[model samples]
Target: MSNSIYDFRASRLNGEEEQLEVYRGKVLLIVNTASECGFTPQYAGLETLYRNLGVRGLVVLGFPCNQFGAQEPGDAAAIGQFCQANFGVSFPMFAKIDVNGDNAHPLYNYLKHEAAGLLGTEAIKWNFTKFLVDRNGQVVERYAPATKPEELTPAIEALL
Candidate 1:
């Protein structure tokens, strides 16, 4: 695995390959999301943050995952529609991915390794686990599933 997130490439909801290099100079909030999870409402706060801080170089990237309780079972198209219709999410969203286990996405594997969760464990416990990446593609911090999006503003501002 490469040292930075720029070394990764992920498929967008539309099925196009997206290079993380495109966001090289921007602060990023990368979250593993689940539409049916209890924390799903965080999507609204995430969208709000994206709209408010985006111009200042904060980009929120949502990655739907179903590894927990099968909370996000929808296909890419269905997930897109659910997000748009429910939370009005306008930020970039990627295809479904696994955040834990042997099948985890490479990008996510790097994130978990960079910033471990409570008790210094690397595995993601649930949906909505967020990884904050700096402009230089460094994984600076990892927010737990229950951490509200608003709580990240201070750290995000510092990076921006």
Candidate 2:
């Protein structure tokens, strides 16, 4: 069995295959995003962090998910455009995925198993839930949906 995030592969927003191993040596902040959620504005903060610290080996990856109240109902092309137009988000975005179910993306399943949430629960509670992975591709921590992106700067910096 795979031990780290590097074992995963996902499709990019454009439908091209993306191997997580490409980001092997970087600090990763992986997020389950939704365009219409109340926390949607956090995209700006995520972009800011990516821009400021990206060069320092930090990579923020956004995975749009529609499982939460149908907040992200658009298809890949539309979702990509929405993020670019509304938040100017430039971080790597994967195709829309199910984050909490039998059909959950493999990477997310791995993440949840690695860092369970409050009370040691492995299920993701809502959109914007974040996972921080270290340079070695090990899941380091899981952030609740209410945890603002800016609040993760120190932890990200430490990993970088």
Candidate 3:
């Protein structure tokens, strides 16, 4: 795929549009999340990372999904509330979006193509899969579902 991660936008939980291009010049961690999944607790770590590094040009974007075992069945409003109450998450969260399937969001499709996972597989295995993008809008790395957000601090720091 083309190195055009900027050519995408996603619907915000608050019913607004967020252009991916607006994040230019920043290192980004894009994740597919699930509130009830095994990796759900990573939300706390992600928020910690975001809060600590946001001013350093690092941003973590969360996109909740139910594509895996119905782990995230809440609608936009519920998902937002749950995150705020449980994890104190303050990162930008997009509306519920499918990460794998015919209805998958275009931004995610680009991520998979740019940074395939284990054994060169491009398909996302489960929830909490992460894609790290560089400041130039290139997908630079892919982390597994179990990769905790805290584990990526070094990489994120290096990029910034």
- Candidate 1, residue 16: CA error in Å? 0.5
lDDT of 1 at 80: 99
lDDT of 1 by residue, 121-155 (tens): 99999999999999999999999889999999999
Q: What's the TM-score of every candidate structure?
A: 0.98, 0.98, 0.97
- Candidate 2 residue pairs in clash (backbone atoms < 3 Å): none
Tens digits of lDDT, candidate 2, 104-139: 999999999999999999999999999999999999
Per-residue lDDT, model 3, residue 151, is 92
Native RMSD of candidate 2 (Å): 0.6
Runs of candidate 3 exceeding 4 Å displacement: none
**Winner by lDDT between candidate 3 and candidate 1:** 1
Residue 30, model 3: lDDT of 94
Give the backbone clash total of model 1. Answer: 0
Against the correct fold, how does model 2 do in TM-score? Answer: 0.98
lDDT string for model 3 (46-153, tens) is: 999999999999989999989999999999999999999999999999999988889999999899988888899878899999999999988889999888888999
Give the distance in Å from residue 91's predicted Cα in candidate 1 to where it truly belongs: 0.4
lDDT of 1 at 157: 94
**lDDT of all predictions, in order shown?**
0.95, 0.95, 0.92
